[model samples]
Target: MAEWLYEAGIGENRAALVSRGTIWKARIELEGTGARVGAILNARLADRSTGKVTLDGGGEALCDPLPPGVTQGGPLRVRIVREAIPEPGRPKLPKAVPSDALPMPGLTLLERITASDVPVRVCRAHEPDLLEQAGWSEVLDEAVTGEIAFPGGALRLSPTPAMTLFDVDGGGPLEPLAVAAAHAVARAIERHGITGSIGVDFPTLANRAARAAVAEAIDAALPQPFERTTVNGFGFLQIVRRRTRPSLPELLRADPIGAETRAELRRIERLPPPPPATHMTTQRIARRLAQQPGWTTELARRSGGTTQFVSAKE
Candidate 1:
């Protein structure tokens, strides 16, 4: 039976759907990403014409279909429809719309996973790390590297402002390679929690029949709830998914130092009894750990040993 295993790690929360001792799907929620989806809050109309509003807390949001007769600078309630998205230069703000609903905080990662149809298993520190045992680290590496190797070839995922592009390459017959790559592409998208616009570049097949076969492979592999164009003569297919939050690649690549810090914490927690007294690593990692006192406290509590950070420089 497949179960959703959730871990409340320091600075981030993780969840994985595991079956047959393998991870089928994984997700990570980083701390302080932004206002979560489904949160209703009060906002002051900043620009009535543009439907721009300032959240009561300290963020900007675009609220469309403004309530009737809402004046500029007037307080109005809004519900968050989408979380902020990270881009190259500046991040896109959370999107909301005017609402009369009561104000409430968004659901936490744990709450969301438990609400899923799959059985939920909350992992404990003292117990074995089920997520790691199910190949969590390898998935993280794949996200950071953007390289997923299949049997015949590999898919290079590149996330750009416009869309996430998957370039498929392998040595073999064009038809077979395209078909195999189609399944691989679907799996990668699902594994990485990739959403929004996506483009897959497969080996061009001149034969109409070959293109149809590749399309059929994609339709069988990828799940629904998405819109995709037919494989064109150029062997390019476009897919669109509902975008709310940043994908896994965006999170890891955006803050590599933070990712490393969390990974180090995971490593330290896995040590045998009487864990190391102090962790010696880069100054950046030391600073990151120090900034999160709660994380250090939890690390100490779990390891049953005092935790300290020393710069490797000395």
Candidate 2:
């Protein structure tokens, strides 16, 4: 049976798509990142330039040429079709249309249950480790330092401003390991919600036949529609995937100042509740944690333990 393991935490919301007890995909939504994908916003055309329309209240979104008879700059109802992602440039809201004329709502991370055809269940919050068992926690950590492992080898995932890159590592037979890396890469991409341009650096393999085998493995692993380059002699393959929302790493690693602080708090939640008392972290982390209003109390409430933070000196 498939289940949607959900945890509504104080700082963020998370969900895991699991099939037969193994998590296939994971999602995280942090506070302050507006939920816009399914949001119906009242907007007016503020400006238009170079194939982009700036909405009055909603920010600029790239759009196709406005259909004839549809003029710009009037009270228009617009729905956010595609969300803005940090990589490969800003969001090009390619599917905004007249709210009166619509087909159906878009499926989003926030609204997966209703949109999904699979049987779904909301996991209990007390069992935070339910999703953690199936590589969920490791991927969260990988969001900070992009390390992922397969049986024979491992790959590191890092996103540059232009594209996300996957570098293959570890020891094994070149062709077989490259094939394994390709499979692992596809799984990691799905699990991490990675999209946009991606470049995979497989270990150098001069033989075209061997490279063909690796490509086949990748195609089998990731059935999602994507445009990809053939593995060259230098062992580099580039793929460009459709971007929907901010990836897991992009959402988590967005601001260094808050990332570690939020991560530590999450770690603390998973621990067996300490005696009802004060807890301490480094002064830097403590200060960041303090910035999140009401989180300490919320954590206490959810964990069934009371934790108070007192100002500390270095």
Candidate 3:
């Protein structure tokens, strides 16, 4: 059975689909990247040439190209394709707002995940570590350093502007072990969200059948809707998976909610008796803490004061 571990950190909610002690899926929901997809909005073309549109909600959206014969500043309807990410001025709208796109409010990602009949547990107290729980520490290490080390050899994963490359280096002649390594690579890719093009450098095999079998082994291990290159004479194979957003490395680097929450928690732990009654943070963090009633109750129980979180701007 699959269970989901949810940690409602300050600015984001981190969730992992844990089954058999392995993380099958991981999701990080930030305040900025909420579910704005498919949101129908009344808009006007502020500048069709530059693909900027003014939404009814105020502020510009980088909309997709208008259908032919549409004029600038004309009243139009568009659907948001992606939510507001931190990098840009405005979220982007799709080229065509399909009439079928539902007019749905943004739903939190964790709500959608737990709605799948999976047993959901609030894991902020345990301070859950999904990667360690999976017992794939080495695999995760590879994700960090770009190398998955096995007993004999290792697969080096590197990211280029185009694709993530996996170079297999220095393994022995154990066919079964080689096959296992191939499967491990596939699992790593899926678990870490290593999307887009991938290249693998398998140990060069003189025998045609051996090379073919290794290729098949790796091909079977990976997920669907991907293209791959067969193992070449120089022992290289490439796989390409469709990509939209940034990969794991990119997310992990900029992920701040968890770290910030933990930092605040640590400060609370070491706080002296005269703690402040008012806790200040961004509105986003305050909202998340409000959702965790039990956490606030516990906070009050530990510290000798009734504490309330408010947005810093307030």
CA lDDT of each candidate? 0.88, 0.72, 0.63
Q: Which regions of candidate 2 fall more than 4 Å away from where they truly are?
A: 19-21, 38-40, 50-60, 67-73, 87-99, 102-110, 267-275, 300-306, 310-314
Q: Is 2 or 3 the stronger prediction by lDDT?
A: 2
Report the alpha-carbon TM-score of model 2 versus the true structure. 0.83
Worst 10 contiguous positions by lDDT, candidate 2: 86-95
- Could you give the candidate ranking by lDDT, starting with the highest? 1, 2, 3
For residues 188-212, could you state the per-residue lDDT of candidate 1 as single tens digits? Answer: 8888889999999998889999988
| Candidate that beats the other on TM-score, 1 or 3, i.e. the better one | 1
Order the candidates by TM-score, highest first — what do you get?
1, 2, 3
lDDT of 3 at 267: 49
Q: Which structure among the candidates has the greatest TM-score?
A: 1
Measured by lDDT, the strongest candidate is 1
Query: Where is model 3 more than 4 Å wrong at Cα?
Result: 34-65, 79-102, 105-107, 115-118, 126-143, 150-152, 174-178, 254-314
Cα TM-score per model: 0.95, 0.83, 0.65
Tens-digit lDDT string for candidate 3 (146-237):
76665666767776656677776654575555566677678768766776678777777667787788778877988797888777787777
Cα error, residue 43 of model 3, in Å, equals 4.6
TM-score of 3: 0.65
